[model samples]
Target: MTKHERGALSANAPKSGEADLETRLSRLRAALDGRAPRLDAPFPAVTLIFSVSDGAARAVTAQGSGATVDAAWEVAVTDLHRKMGRRKLRGRFLRLDWVEKAETWTWALLRKRLREVKRNYSRRGIALEKGFTHLFLEQELNGNAMLYGGNQISHCVVNEKNFLIYAQQKYGSGITVDFADDREVHVFDTAGLFCGEDGVLHELYGAGRNAGRRKIDPLDVDTLRGIIGDASDFLAHQVGADGRFIYGYHPCFDRQIPAYNALRHASTTYSMLEAWELTREPGLLAAIERALEYLCRQFIRTAGDDMAFVVDTGDEIKLGANATAILAMSKYASLMGTDRYAGIMENLACGILHMQAEDGSFTHVLTWPDLAVKERFRIVYYEGEAAFALMRLYSLSKDERWIAAVEKAFGHFIEKDYWKHHDHWLSYCTNELTLYRPEMRYFRFGIRNFEGFLDFVLQRITTFPTLLELMMAGRKMLDRLKAMPEGAELLAGVDEAKFEQALHFRASYLLNGHFWPEYAMFCRNPDRILGSFFIRHHAFRVRIDDVEHYLSGLVAYADYIEAVAGSSDGAVRA
Candidate 1:
């Protein structure tokens, strides 16, 4: 038969009528005794036949006359050999057949001897399969084996000769394989492998294969301080001498996507300020100043009426941009103990307030130079953000107008149940407002919102089907931990101690995963350094807001935990 025809028949098992017990025994005896012709096999043949049932082994002495049935079994075996010779099978294979009515024989075999090769060279480990030499072996959380080669990696299954050839081509003549195996094995590459000072494998990326893993104990204050410091340094590097921070990055392509957002720039600056407050790092302070300058110089635009708002580039004005700028500048002013940017903050605040409707919902966007409304539609976040900014302004300046605006806007927010959506900023604003005003209803609302958030997190953790969901869920859990203490006593149906323990466990799981597998997903290029994509389901584009949210959430939680540790009573203060 032709190769194609033989390949198709390889999937078919021997039929029951093809060989009975006596006929199969006679053919096997003839083949073993050299009474049958040795088949012209296309590849090396190794066959193992056994019974599924526990039975006594008996010698076959009966001779049969079913030549047609015996010939069919021979053809089936030869066809399988041909398919193996052509490397048709890519994964594990198995087959079963019933030879008679009451009895059946089982066959267990490895058709390809070198499907996955495991070898040791001078105490170093190497896994060679299908032209790829895997230097690193990792088992995923779901129990799948991953083999990492220099240029590529394979998941779950490995192919034999192809891996070896690929490894030799990539690693050169030094690549040596001493043995091959049918079973998968974990092999370590002593030469190319990297381990951190913590003794964890260091993730590498790009042509330099620079180690990307940042070892930090999430629970340790000093470790959190160091992470914040390092992140601040990365942000510092992203800032151009012209004061523009690199905004968008694509990791898989190792390229920058030229886009910018004023809102993200403001929030990122706010995070840097928080980092600086924690560590007093001179570099972080400098970067924060540069970013603040960028927002003032390029982002702020004035309308025809001299009402100033922060805009992305020149004409696109978003309420979120103005609110974020007001928030960041106000924090910087408070941190510096000077009113250096107080006027700018007031102007941004006024711009946001102008956009608010009588009902307290802010218009989402506007066209700049002319100040024409671009989008009158209400979104879930900007109103809460504006209210929070107003509250912060009031706290800083003791402005009654700002406080009155917040009171009205926040009442509208609660009446509308805006916190029902995935708006952490809403929770943040309500949490802050509760502390300032001490309204039982506001506090209760904050608790209920966090409870809902926790439920969402629990659901995501239990049903984490994608890496993005896992990462995002971990981040949301941290947010909950940071916010929970404020309303711990108010949380209904939850034991505070158990809730804290669950948060700690969730944090540990996230940190462990991030330090190992997830770190590799971040782009390491200087332009796209430390940027993460949105969800795994979306296009692989990294936005500044993604980085901003991650940093702010982590820094806020770390600070909260550290503060709780330092308290004399060891109790979380309301």
Candidate 2:
């Protein structure tokens, strides 16, 4: 019988009386309290909800149920946990299946069932002997069993064959298997059999059944520093001698995507510059110099009237590219204490300024060779990027024109409701502008934008399934959250609980997010293996901007923390 069928039967079984239910609850509590219960005793099936905090686990609630414990455990972990504060350290649901087992009976039965399943698959022309390294089995009261097999790489591959179809055909209908490659699969089993070919079935069962109860260590700053260092090294090593970075990587296939984006390239260079500033790493500085050379030699172009702009080597002259180039050049000039890129920066800044409409929004793109306007519609981030670039130029030269353009652009950005979007570039530009200009309106708008961001985070925190999303949202808001006046009536309607929860969860998310890129490393070639920042919700496509934004956020947060260290308020100053 299928596990689901057995589960349905179990759910419909007669429930014990109230007294028996109380007895089972007491036994479950005893187990949680570290007191040994009668493991051989058959007690009423129960679902125990646990909350683990600060290294202690306790049963927060319990419910009587005849359903299979795994089903209840899954529901508790996914459904119930979703309703709880994600800031809660570790919340899990565990099932205590009431069964009496003879010594080694469960393990032996499980192994026998696995072999049977393997033979069945073999008869169907799908070999199962080679990769049948692990087995998970569960049996019902009716003596029927369900089986699953896995391979060495933690994949549920029972051979170099289609295991999903094999399981379904051998186990009959209602046998569901969720497979990701051949390494992972979700299988349903009952006779309480979980074993691996490594002869560590007991260990696997002990760990797997309580997986949801595992505690996640608090975000570690040292670990984050290590990841940042690794990412910096990856960026430095990926830079060609000519200064071009490997622009795109496809992790699944371990291949380099032969593509490039000028805006992304410039932004990545700017991040590398920031890394150099933070780490004073000689290799990073060398890489930055090489990248600067490539940017200046190949990307800078003279439009009509000797108006210079930074364009992609073989692509359109995007406004974003020009804006990012201006920032990168300005930063490089500041680092070297020279006006080496001053003329080029001014030319690029002017090219962008010329594209700006009188109201302040810049045209999106232009054709490279012909210098004809290619796209005029306002894209998501280019306007903010352009404004920030102009502001950076203003900082470098004390040019009133740059400020004048930014003032006009700020007015246009406000009128266009850019604050309503979760665009970090807008917040970043506005924040820097506030530092330079210190206008009350700029501060107010910046706070309002962050309020919107907090609201976005609050609304989505419970819905975030992965640590990457949580970290992205957290990093985007950290600086603003730190800079806002403590106890300020910001995010007007958001209560203090939610605000604190957001902060707490963000701290937890950073550690997880920092280490997440390691998962995207290409494993096929150790020498060529490198980390790539990916979009988790998408098909995990790696992009240069992904790394750029991640590095920028990390560095910015680190700077904020360092600046606030000696302050009495211990908060970032606006």
Candidate 3:
């Protein structure tokens, strides 16, 4: 008659015992369907990075003078070329024909073309040399210290030389060009430099605290030039025989997809045009086409349950592995063209949707094989992460379906009241999720109160049967039933074995659930490392930031108290 008595008897009822089974099923279903009441309300931070776009496309909406250095520099080059009476000698943009020619042509001919250009530049003196050296040097010297680490320097150098030769052959050596370490040299912004937080120098020159380093490094004009050169060269040409850029990496899923480093090189080749300083390199349009094709193949072959992606098995069960791959695939598909991949992307999105739990948590594959849900689910950070990706997809396609899916799935954070906790785990977990939502739109992500989120989760575990205890209890009961005489036959009628599947799910959820040990973000700082080897401190830090100052532990405690009072545990445990 009581709720406690009702829940207990419900699980014990025979499938053929219509009244008891119906009563149990009805309560369980009602618990699931009951209005998921959200108590507190307030505004919060809106977090999400805008998607990448070409300068020309972004320029339309981009505020400011609407001037790019490449454009200005191009005009300057034309003027200088006319001054030298060699206006027709500029480098032919590297087209697909050139790539094919280089692929098939021996280094001997490529070398010969180089010698002839050198001859012309030498004759033109500083005017021609200045243009050539500046253009080529900048390409060779620029680099991203964060991405390539110490390797950025070497990458820039190789790409620079190649671009120089290509430029000489197309443009008569009438333009001057050269490169040097931007740090050691002085350069000026023709349009006057922006000192604002999101200025060009800040973005390209490495101003602000390098999230890679806690210290802020102001952008140097020279460094910006070098970075632009390095980025351009890396993006434009194959640095070597492997058909890769300077770092020989791809920009997609920096950690998840295999050969990501190489793929990054490839992706940046196309994606970096807006950021890096450079005119349209002769071969860039074709390179963009090729890069997109390669990227598409990478996505199709690796972003699913049976794909060639990183964390494809039990080996690399880190937090964002599968979801990151899926995110990359969606972005790449949208950027390339939707007509070809709308259906496949929809299916992938659907698969992830099916994995959601009643509590709004998701399971990583570590504990459960795949569909096992015996244990109470642990919050997997990826659920929140994948929601960001979904939000981004909505932004790109303006698809109502994608927006709806993101709203529902991401709304889980509020439903579970998971973001109110404070801890490094909550910091990293919630930061990415909240980044994607519209400003102050969601209840959970509404503001900074992560301390509250952590308190709520811990309070719930202490107040009620913890997720692990629930799993153990559920399993124990199932085992007892299995041991009964004719238990197998009886179970067939009630589908006890079918119900037992939740155990595996529960285990998997526990294995993959989110925990905010300091280790989620950085490796070097001893404070950031957790107890898991699969999760490297380095990977965490490289991927996200540490936002602990703005968290609320108080809110999390409140949620815990509520779940304890309302759930089956209230009757069973109390």
Local distance difference test, per candidate?
Answer: 0.48, 0.51, 0.30
Q: Rank the candidates by lDDT, best first.
A: 2, 1, 3
> What's the C-alpha lDDT at position 343 in model 3?
52
* Model 3 lDDT per residue over 476-500, tens place: 3334445555345433444334333
Model 3 score (lDDT): 0.30
Which regions in candidate 2 have their CA more than 4 angstroms from the true location? 1-216, 304-306, 313-315, 458-504, 507-523, 526-532, 563-574
TM-score of every prediction relative to native:
0.59, 0.60, 0.31
Q: Model 3, residue 417: what's the lDDT?
A: 60
Q: Which structure among the candidates has the greatest TM-score?
A: 2
TM-score of 3: 0.31
Reference-based lDDT, residue 288, model 1 = 84
Instruction: Please tell me which model should have the higher lDDT, number 1 or number 2.
Output: 2
Q: What are the runs in model 1 whose C-alpha is more than 4 Å off?
A: 1-218, 304-306, 459-495, 509-542, 567-574
Could you tell me the lDDT of residue 557 within candidate 3? 19
State the lDDT of candidate 1 residue by residue for 382-452, as single tens digits. 77678778878888998887877877787777788765664667656765565567665675565455454
Could you give candidate 2's per-residue lDDT for residues 1-574 as a string of tens digits? 2111111112222243222222332333333332112222133232323221111221222122224454444553453344334435332222332222212223233343345442212111111211211222221100011222322222111331333443543345666543323333222221211111111111011212112111223223333354566667778887899888888654433468797777878888888887777778898889988988898887888877647877775557888889899888888887879898888888888898888888888888888777788889657778878888888888889999888999899898788877766466676677668667766566556655645355555444222222222233333443454466641443344454554455445433333222121122112222343333443222234566676766766665555445544364333211
Worst 10 residues of 3 by lDDT: 93-102
